[model samples]
Target chain A: MSLLSVRSLRVTYGGIEAVRGIDLDVAEGELVALIGANGAGKTTTLKALSGMVRPAGGRVTYKGIDVTGMASHHLIRQGIALVPEGRGVFARLTVEENLAMGAYTRNDPPGVSADLDRVFELFPRLSERRAQVAGTLSGGEQQMLAIGRAMMSRPRLMLLDEPSMGLAPLMVQKIFEVIQSISAQGVTILLVEQNALLALEAANRGYVMESGAITMEDAASALLESPQVREAYLGQ
Target chain B: MDIFLQQIINGLTLGSVYAIVALGYTMVYGIVQLINFAHGEVVMVGAMVALWVITALAGSGTTLPPLVIVLIGTLCAIPACMAVGYAMERIAYRPLRNAPRLAPLITAIGISIILQHLAMLIWSRNPLAFPQIISNPVFHLGGATISGVQIAIISLSLLMMAALTLLVYRTKLGVAMRATSENPEIAGLMGIDVNRVISITFVIGAALAAVAGVMVGTYYGIAHYTMGALLGMKAFSAAVLGGIGNLAGAMLGGMLLGVVEALGTGYIGNLTDLCHVSWISSDLAERCAVDGHVILFGSNYQDVFAFVVLILVLVFRPSGLLGERVSDRA
Candidate 1:
């Protein structure tokens, strides 16, 4: 059974439909990439899944429960976490505080502390700047902190939105490696990205989204070779 | 020199009161970006509740110690004001949270008016003299006399501010609050209950307002429905003066404003009286010469100083003295 399955899910913003009856699935432990151009309703879809925005229509089931339109905090408590677009780290808070906030729902102090150390282990640069205010960090460092902070939640499924957005090539490479490492640790991931090739290469499977609907879905390598995807997304 | 010392002491006492009240404004503003114009009314509510409790207690002829009666009064006031504050958020402000920014502001003013009237109806329009039941011993140092009331206000304000600072920077809930203030949606994604944080913010702010209310009433020996209007405005100005969302800035702004007002009042008469304004008008100059003084303004204009500093701060540094660089982003 799929860990997360969506049936004809629709999302609207200000009377305009952003996600149009899109069906998708992510089985447990699989890395799924939702790739699309800008304004392809990718972010909105993630927003709906994470309960940031109310779904205008349809059903979203996680682990066989109909969890449509749950509050963000409720979804988060059920082991779902979103690294929102633009890396929304609390700017004025220190890096340590940011990570601590990620574990706000957890009451097990020792376990949370352990998870925090694990996050620090994964991102040494974040460990070095743990005491620094998040606002002062560079864009790359902020993205790293954002991911590390999300990891502190010890989520079962992680939704990443454009982790590579606005980062240098080297930084993007570093981030993708960290993401693949996270997936290897048995946490399911649904990565949304504008960078088609990068997302597809890191993903186990891929879906092509355009104009608020899914156009195609295939193995990551198959999507990489598709003529339509090559002409439109891969810049061939 | 003695006068200078005395004025400084007076200023410290007054500034601490302003600081305490200003924290309420800043904390609520920081979490929810609402000025909460009715916050002063919450202070008024605190004072009124304290007055009611003390009056009832004192009249009942209970054997409770004087200090115990005062403490009971404060205990009663804190929860009452907190309830008032929470209701204001849940009923008036929360419904308008996503409405146009101007909507909440107008609603704030409406709540302020409503609260003032409600207080008037409950407490009667006449000012109630807050009973000074406990014995207070005054202290003297360096030719300046500091009353026990002044000492209590200053020390209590300092203690509260310190505790608040520790709470915000150290605790789990504090981090959740900071997160929610920064981004409510993202904070919710981390399983932090944003609404609960906001409600708690209002409650904490109201608690501080309660203490400040009691302090203001005790210092002046009276409580009136209208007292909160000017006090609230002054505290709001102090919050803005210290950078609205920054905690430390609010405290600094409060103390500085207090000192400035005190010093301005102390010297405005002296400076204006000695001035020879021949350029203003020949008649005025002649009058000054005949009377040997201008005597333009005095302690009655002390309220003018707070507004003047506010205008000057707005004109020169609108972001406030400690306003952070908000442009930093990912």
Candidate 2:
């Protein structure tokens, strides 16, 4: 059974279908990448899965429980966490407060404190600026805070959307390394990115989406080697 | 000097009530941009409910203490207003969340009217005397005097404001509310129920409104259906003056508006008396005469000062004194 499964999930904005009947699966502890062009419904799929947007059609089952159209907060408690694009850190809140909000549903104070310390350990830069408002942080630092905030949920499955966007090459490398390390620690991840080369490198398996549909699915290396993928996404 | 001190004390007491009411207006407006015009009516409902409870308790001739009776009445008002606030959000505004912005604004006015009429039907159209349930002992402070009710109103309002500050900045719910206010969709991504946060904001504001209701009724010695209309407008003005979306702004706006209106009403006749225009007709000049002035407008024009200040604020500083919080774009 997959840790996260999407079967023919469809999401529409007004009249236009953003995510049209897409099927996706991420096995437990597996790092899967969903790579596509902009406007290919990658973000919409994640939105529907996290219940940010109501699905126009389809079903989503997480950990064998059908969670289609469940609200985001409930999904979050069910151990599904999404680090949204554009680094959706609470800009007005301090870095520390932003991280505390991540563990909003948890009641175990000691466990939450432990997780906070772990997040600080993972992103030492965040630790130094814990008192500063997130809006004041540099782009790379905000991205780091967003990821670290998600980690505070102690999620079983993580959905990361374009963590590399608007970041420098060095920061992107650092973010991907963190992604791989988090995956190595036995967290199932569904990574959506425009940078297919980097995404495929970090992923165990990969699916290529084009025009709201999955056009290719294979092992990460196989997708990397495919001439079509190399032309369309790899920019080679 | 004594008059000035007394007016200041009076202004502060009134300011406390305005601040409490303004919080409701600013908080709901802050989160969803809905003015929640019905919020004032909730304050009225709170006062009316308290009066009804007090009237009933007195009619039964129970041996309960006067303070205990007033306390019970106040306790009843809180939940009643909270329910009113909740229903306004859930039924009147929530369904129209995605509708045109004008729809909610218009709906708020409609709800305000409906609540006013409902109160008229439930209670009386004319002002009813709010019983003097407490022995309001006046205490001298410097040259100014502070009554027991005034002290209670000021202290209670300050306490609520402090609690609100703690709630907004200190609690998990507070962070969630701020996040929702900043970006509802992203807050949802962070596992916040934006709708719930908005509802809670309305409820908290309503609770404050209820307390203000009791305070106003006690202060004025009357519980009238229309009282909330003017009071609500003044509070709204205060919120705008303090920068509508900022919590501290609402508090500051409210207190300032109250004090300004009080002082304006207290001295407007005298201030107008100072204006000596020699060229004016004797009849009109008498109204603004140099020495022996005809009292053109006295404290009876208390309501006018709030609107005048409001006009001045809108014309010069539309963002408000604290400046409208430029929260990041959703």
Q: How would you encode candidate 1's per-residue C-alpha lDDT over B111-155 as one tens digit per residue? A: 999999999998899999998887888888889889988998999
lDDT of 2 by residue, B1-330 (tens): 478888888999999999999999988887997787778899999999999998899779899999999999999999999999999999989999999888998999999999999999989789999988889998898887889999899999999999999999998999899988888887876778888999999999999999899999999899999888889999999988898888899899988988898889889888765345544676666555545665568778889988998999888888888864543322
Weakest ten-residue segment in model 2 chain A by summed lDDT? A11-20
lDDT of 1 at A170: 99
Tens digits of per-residue lDDT for model 1, A127-190 = 9999999999999999999999889889889999999999999999999999999999999999
Task: State which candidate has the highest DockQ.
Answer: 1
After superposition of all CA atoms, the RMSD between model 2 and the true structure is 2.2
C-alpha DockQ for predicted model 1: 0.87
Worst 10 residues of 1 chain A by lDDT: A117-126
| Most lDDT-accurate candidate | 1
Error of 1 at A133 (Å): 0.9
TM-score of each predicted structure versus truth: 0.96, 0.96
Least well predicted 10-residue stretch by lDDT in candidate 2 chain B: B321-330
